[model samples]
Target: MSWLALWLLGAGLCDLAHSVRPARHLPSAVGAAGTLLFGLLAGLSSGADLAALPLLAGAVAGWGYLVTFGFGRGRAPMALAGYAVVTGLLLLIAQQAGAVGGAFGRWVESTPLPVLAERDPEQVLLLLAVLVAQMSTGNVIVRLVLAATGTVNPGKGPDATSTLKGGRLLGPMERVFIVGLGVAGHATAASIVVAAKGLLRWPELQARRDAATGPSIDDVTEYFLVGSFVSWLWALGGLVLLA
Candidate 1:
């Protein structure tokens, strides 16, 4: 659970750093160092073997650095690959150390908060991570997919400008709604969110359709379709992790 929290914290902070302009590297560096320190403390507090500390610190720090670097450079594929590899390795290590059932779990179980009384700390940490991922991290991932598939390009172009306008706010809200609905076993209701987005954007999309300049309708539609799908997938993936 601690590892999971640390992983999420590292990833989230790195993504946050990537989202900020000017002095991005500073946050990335600080985030990586913070993750390492917190990871070490978490490990020790959880009674994990001292011998595993180095590997744990290395994994957390490396994840932060790689994610920050990859996103900063617009290397979506590299960031995605790094995430997979590092998270996989961390999961394996956690399994070996039996790190999921420790002080955090006990505390979560004993908590008085009605909302969390029945939930484990792992679930809570995972939800927190998912929420964080739904922010800039999710946007970065969607853009990466779009770029990789040639559906969009980065710049001040029509599609890019349109997305840049409100996507940062909308993406996180939709993801949180989707994940929340799915967690509550109301997945069918989640479709309303998808519909609402389309309806709300219909006016804007229509307005753009007849514009004398900017990207073609095809490019805009493709960007919307691909980006929305990828964003929703992130939320669904979080649901899977929770399960």
Candidate 2:
């Protein structure tokens, strides 16, 4: 029943809500609840029975519980890995969802929401979910990776990755651009975007080498590289789903 799309929609909404409040350690119960509500609406609107409710609610709850209990602990890497594995599993199964499928997709097509009604609703919903997830959830996921794998510091924090600025904003913009390009059949052009980021940040990295505080030059570089790669992968993964 469009489990993949439904889960992505739920996870995206959860991250979005958390991002708005700007709290990393906070739980995403609201988003979880939102998922259930969307499921219920989609089911009812599409004239489907409520039999899928138990599974739907359980899945959303489990995801929410994982994310809610995972962060801010010493197990960031483990938690991140778990999340990735689940996402991959979902993506694998998403293909099994037949066309015109997912009560959500049908319900979306039934709406008077202009533009949205005319296209493949499942694709649109999935695309929208990816875009929304990239906006906030992408940043959070990168942060999780950085927190665990950031460069080593003897007397300082593991990462102290706040040396470079504007990444939170820049990462999302670049990801959206890449996803859009991929979806538009210009995937090869994404290399330009990748190159552009390195060129643009070269000066900042150089300047950080002489900075009086924060992570060392190498640490900052590692932070940038790791975060950037993760962000790119997240975006590319979404593009793959679209493909």
Candidate 3:
């Protein structure tokens, strides 16, 4: 396994652990720390295996931006969409930049030490698909499950998603279920990407005004649905170019 992948996997685990405990700020703090640690580790691990580093860095940057700027007060569907897009863009930009050296500066220099270079085109494409799904679903599940379980309580007043601000939505068993669901969702998306382009297309486009005609079920359905679709699209693009 790539060192950057290991570090990121570890950090993601830490974030999950922190979400388990709501009484203490330690969980959130640990999560933030884990994000930063993953970024640094990615930079250090890049070497010649640049792709791994970008995936890790993108995840870290996405989480970092969400934690830093904070989401809007209203659960307005548009606001939520904006938030998700911004987070996704931050991650994508960071991953692309750091992986192949865009604007973050060349943090990793080539060296002569033997490294486990994964050159299989098919494997590389699969890895990219899995990595994107992992980060996106991991994040969404954390929030939804945490809120559902009462591990984190939605704050008083009108916010989107749930009724609690901070708490795990489900218990240990349910949390496991969430993780499983995330993995399954990733696989499902990948299969769709590999199968048909039409399978990934979303709901029909709506006029800006007609968008509000419904009960706004779009809040929950849109992000995950569109997100999963887009991630696979990204993976497909990578696969066509690389694989």
Candidate 4:
């Protein structure tokens, strides 16, 4: 669980760093350093075995670096998804060995909150990490999926996002809302909210249908559907991972 959380944290922070500066190597370097530092913290706190720290840290750093360096390539999304699948396998092996909780579990018991603070520390940490991922990392994945699916052409330059506008921001907000509702045990409500997004964006999509510039209505509609569905699945999948 800790490893998965760390992977998510590394991904989200790496994407945020790249979005902030978009440098050739700065974001990867920052993410790797941050992941390693956090790995050391986990070891020191006995949240993970000392002997396993090196391997865990290596995984986090390697994946983080790859995320920064893999963007814009044809197979980048597939590669990233493959790494996620591998991480899941690693997590299963790690859990089978023994309990993953330690000092963080103890710390959670010490928290003042009656509800949230009483929950598992790894859960809380992962929730925070997923929320962060929903911001930038999710957007990155959606764009990659859009490109991969031909809904938007990355090679052609300026995908629907540039024309659609507000997607990069609206996406995070919507995903966070859905995740929050899920956490609050309002899955049905969350689904309703997800449905409302299409309605809310209907006018905008309709407006594009009659436009003379920017992405075509067909392209924009596909972008909306694909991106929204990807984001929804990502948020839901994160919850499943936490489980």
Candidate 5:
């Protein structure tokens, strides 16, 4: 089978594991096995030398998801640790695979999209912009969804805190930490992509929502907190995969 085909299979398996875990609550070992299979196949396509890259990424992702969602009270340390573990594993795979070829050299040559390729600055700056855009956009989108679904305060006049309560957004602390961790992950992955391909794409700002208010402060805070994490995931994924 082709490498890309193998990657597709692995990705499918990974998603399957994710889907089954919530309903069936499969054993952690089963999930680990799935990740192992995914890593093996994904490494084949990525030319990542680390034989265990898939396992590592899966474990980190699982831990992050669990700590933030499944068990704990959404600690920042867990999020940060998860990001570090995943990114480090990816880099190790790249190195082992001998894929780190002329990272900075390629940036001078060409890019996939002339427009997005033009914005190749330090990974930190790029990461920041992408993260901000993601959070802001997600906040707006989630708010609209809530308002349309009658979940949030309607007809305006509510403050930002009230409007966002019960909307799946995390509290202020969680939001800040998750955003920071996500940006870090993006930077790490972006660095790898840039090093390998020379060119990368910049994410665009798509939307913005009014910070309207609602009745419940607690609900809005939670919505913002949850939404922030989601935003981080979206932004980080886009930077690493889309770029």
Candidate 6:
């Protein structure tokens, strides 16, 4: 569980660093290296068998590579598929090692926070991973989906800066809201959030329809619909993991 926390924290920091234009590959590289080192240290501290260390290190390294470089360079579908595979493998390893229970579970149970008190460490780690994904990773997924579906063309008309102002901030906020509501057992409220987002964006979308220049209404609408649905799906998927 400590190793899981370290990996997630590293991944989240890497994603946050990559969000800044000036701090590109170096931050991610350092994060990958750090995750490997810290994960090993965590395993050692937690008294995990030495035999499992290599596999744990390898999994952390692989996850770092996927999030930082593989996803950055590879096709969207392939990268996303690889992410799912690696995540599943890591969870399996954790489960087998008994790292998903025991001390970590006790710690979580002792914590006073209502949101976390009932959660096992594995679920908490998974929630943290999901939150991190909702940040820059979510943006990557949305853009990749749009690109794959031909709803958006790279290096063409109104770049992200000119067109989708504030989307980066908005995407994470909405995902967090949805995930929080769902975790609190407010599924209907989460649905309302989904509808409200569409309503809020409707005016802008309609304005685009009236404009002569910029991306066509159809293109913008497709981008919004595809991106929003994929983003919501990621949050919902996280909720499923918590369950």
* True-structure RMSD, every candidate: 3.3, 4.2, 12.1, 3.2, 13.5, 3.9
Tens digits of per-residue lDDT for model 3, 1-243: 233233334334444554455334454445445544543544433443445444444444444334323333322233335335644554454343333222111322332222213233222323333343345334443343333333312133244333211222222222233333333444344443334423322233222224443324344344334433444443333233222
Q: List TM-score per model, in order.
A: 0.80, 0.78, 0.33, 0.82, 0.35, 0.77
Task: Kindly list the per-residue Cα lDDT of model 4 for residues 1-243, writing each as its tens digit.
Answer: 666666677667777888899787777666666665655544434434554555555665565566654565576677568567757776786563323345555666687876567566667767877788888888877877776676764124554334556778888898889888888777778888787888988988888788776677887787778888998998888767655
* lDDT string, candidate 2, 21-125, tens digits: 745433356666766676554543333324444454556556555555556656667767766776777667655544444566666767886546755766676
Which window of ten consecutive residues has the lowest lDDT sum in model 3?
163-172
Write candidate 1's Cα lDDT for 77-152 as tens digits: 8868877776677666665443434555566677897656766665666666667777777877787777667675
Report the number of the highest-TM-score candidate. 4
- Residue 143 CA displacement from its true place in model 6, Å: 2.0
- Backbone clashes in candidate 1 total 0
- Which is the winner by lDDT between candidate 4 and candidate 6? 4
- Return whichever of 3 and 6 wins on TM-score: 6
N/CA/C clash count, model 3 = 19
**What TM-score quantifies how close candidate 3 is to the native fold?**
0.33
Overlapping backbone residue pairs in candidate 2 total 0
Residue ranges of candidate 4 with Cα displaced over 4 Å: 43-48, 96-106, 153-162
lDDT tens digits, residue span 15-54, model 5: 3344346443343344445444533432333534354445
Indicate which candidate wins on lDDT: 2
- State residue 239's C-alpha deviation in candidate 1, in Å: 0.7
Ranked by lDDT from best down, the candidates are: 2, 4, 1, 6, 5, 3
lDDT computed for candidate 5 = 0.37
Q: How far out, in Å, is residue 197 in model 1? A: 0.8
